[model samples]
Target: MTNHNLYLRLVGDRFEKTASQPFLIIPGRRPLLFSELDRMTGCVAARLLELNVEPGDRVMVQVAKSPESVLVYLACLRIGAIYTPLNPAYTTAEVSYFMTDSKPQLLICQPIERESLFDLSLACKVPHIRTLGSDGDGDLMHGLESLTPEMTVVEREADDLAAILYTSGTTGRSKGAMLTHHNLASNAEVLHSYWHWQDQHDVLLHALPVFHVHGLFVALHCALLGCSTVYFLSRFDTGQVIDRLPDCTVMMGVPTFYTRLLSDARLTPELCSKMRLFISGSAPLLAETHREFEQRSGFQILERYGMTEAGMITSNPYHGDRLAGTVGYALPGVSVRIADNNGNELPRGEIGVLELKGPNVFKGYWQMPEKSAAEFRQGGWFISGDNAIMDQTGRISIVGRAKDLIISGGYNIYPKEIEAVIDTIPGVAESAVVGVPHADFGEAVAAIVVKDGSRQLGEQEIIEPLQGRLARFKQPKRVFFVDELPRNSMGKVQKAELRDTYKESFGSK
Candidate 1:
């Protein structure tokens, strides 16, 4: 593992091979080739040295996505410092928890949030603070311009910490998942071949936020390894994605992105004619949306499953059947199995907890030894906490989250199973199911829905479909309609907030 310690250095070696070739292509901005990015990252790395960032020191970056932000990550890697990225959507109070836990050597934030983040940094006693903006005008850029290019690569072992990504923490306080050089490098290498990377010919439609795993690790890692060009859009806009689809070859996104794009009349097969692959992850994709997208675009979506801890677990095969509901098989060099609650492996077709053993799995939760210990089994298998079933051919279909299971009237019910039925209903667009406290049973099932834009969908229309479809215990006891479901930055539904909002729906108070 230590042999490939310099992940960025290896990419730098590739950059040297393709120095003058374009690496990043923004719509209105000047594109940067491999050699230009090299000098820019070197300058940023020198500035990081000026800030006294030591090897293995953590640098918490909560800035908006930009090419300069990419330079910051590369700078950290070039200097062998840990690169910890935070979603710019994080408020000051939310950021305090991460700052307090990670205890980084430096803190970087947006220009507008700098005052608030600086105050928090002082309260937290962090030494250095800097600002970076989406349009590339900030103190960090000024600092970068003043420094001469320092073409030095710090040496780090493979197991040494490279970055710390905080989990979504749906249940409780967020835990930082520590990723090493090996963990990231291994996953990226496997994915390039697994996803059929097009080398210098590939152009990535990078509209996903870079703070999360999907954009930060999987997408960028593949592009950098392949020495590909990235069309780095600031955010995912349906119009922008459609406009750029004709110029790019690969696109990665959550299910929401596809649904929104499918809503527009601009998402025809001709619009995406130049697009070679459409990859989706970060949240579950509804089967209805999947079938509809295939019909509209004349291409099946290649959906993958991963978490903050594990980079890319299972991906639909590049050449084979990209099945509608399955996350396909485990990626090369990754071992995935179904296990009972007691940690015993279950046979295929049996519903149980999923366990994954792979190099892509993180080291552990930051500074939470006891909490981290409970997450892994004896043989290094990390309990995924997802309830899934494997078909005889080794394809994995996630039924629901284990924590999302509703035990009503002493019977086990999975919300995904009910939501799938609700989503396919004629007028329903999407749905989320959560269990809340109840006086009769331990918990009651509730469904929050968003209707298809064509018509107004009522509660009866939603509940009526589940009448014969699901068992009485599995059906939603109460239906709530909303214009949109609450989602995180990565587009996963905020079910914990839903449970909190409806905690008293069944007269718990």
Candidate 2:
């Protein structure tokens, strides 16, 4: 039987040849080589085994991004333990909910948070707890030199669970998405080829957080598969990214990153001359941002579409025309179609729910069998809950989330349509359109906008222009201006929060 462990597929055969090569280049710290990373993971795996962490046991980790934190992830994979990572920004109440749900045998948190989390862990019935700090000092790495390394990779079937990542839970309690060895491995391999990863030559500017799929699986996995050097950043900083752009070949980031870069005076085409690709995901990339980035940097941003349930469904081609508003063709071996609520496929150029079926799709939502079953159709297609349209050329353009659809006077209004127009207006930076409760219309369209600070503007200025451009029902009845919009960790606007904030906008109408 074959050992289908994800660790082996990622680092087994190429270890010796790439041992001395630089793996991670961190600012103000020594570069960590592939051999050092391997040794560290081995030691961490040995430590996990010492704690009696057997195969399939859940290992929950919530530590700040660092080389040592990554070692914990690789260590879990090495021993065939199901790795569960949480955002470091999650509150104690949120952590408690995850702990009670996952019921992990072992929990690793930051040293500063250990005292509080220790009590929480005991209350949640988690057996063991350890700490790993951002600077590589904590209980998890104590006395590593004396311990023997665990060099043997545990055997796992392709269908065995490898990780469980939770959703953002904007609408309700977050559901854990169970990912198997094959689910992650197949996606990584396909992306390695699809993105044209160049072995030993590509230097990746990795600024995205490691807790999410964009940074952890898509970015890191591709770099590991190609033995590429990564410029590991603690967080996304505009100055750091601009300084490192000349030395890097590829950068994967959210749309916010590009917008921030464009705002800076230091950004120039010469600074990004060495960059080969700039890929954006985790949130929608506005057509205006895409066009501005290309105009300033002399490179088009490759926008892709994906979700927590699936690693990656579609991507703009690496060697072809990357249309500004479209997330180009579905990946090889992945099937995508626009479908109605009943799951019947829609014809080309029509908007409907996007459904996908592929190896990269997750097994199911953890411990929520009914919810998982409800998300899939009879033919094993996963309902993506996203409204999208397919072009004649097979490219997919996401309109908005189904939950973001606004119904006013019995007319369906897509938020993206309003946002796109608002973003194009002079002195308007960005906008988020949402539906608020209204006694008359059931729901009334509302707009929350951010101005570019170039000129003074009023609600009338924003509303007057939309009168001719949009239908009366589709236009926002109320326009509210703010310095910025609320966003999640991945840079996605929190529309649910907006809806809640402005629920009484109509004054009990």
**Clashing pairs counted in every model:** 0, 0
RMSD to the true structure for each prediction, in A, is 11.0, 11.1
Off by over 4 Å in 2: 404-509
What is candidate 1's lDDT per residue for 1-509, written digit by digit as tens?
23455455346666766787778887788887887877888899998898899998999999988889999998898888999998776667668988999999999999998877788899998999999988888888885666788787777888888899986443436689999988998888999999999888889999888887889888998888889888888888889988889989999987767878888888889988888999988666767778999999988999999888988999999999999888989999999999999899999899999999989999999998998999999899999999999999999998777776565543445676678778898888899999887644546789999888877677788888776455465678899988898999999899989999999987743
lDDT of 2 by residue, 231-326 (tens): 999988889999999999999987768878888888888998888999988766767778988999999999998887899999999999999988
Judged by whole-model lDDT over C-alpha atoms, candidate 1 comes out at: 0.84
Model 2 residue 53 CA deviation in Å? 1.1
Best by lDDT: 2
List lDDT for all candidates, in order. Answer: 0.84, 0.87
Return the TM-score for each candidate structure.
Answer: 0.81, 0.81
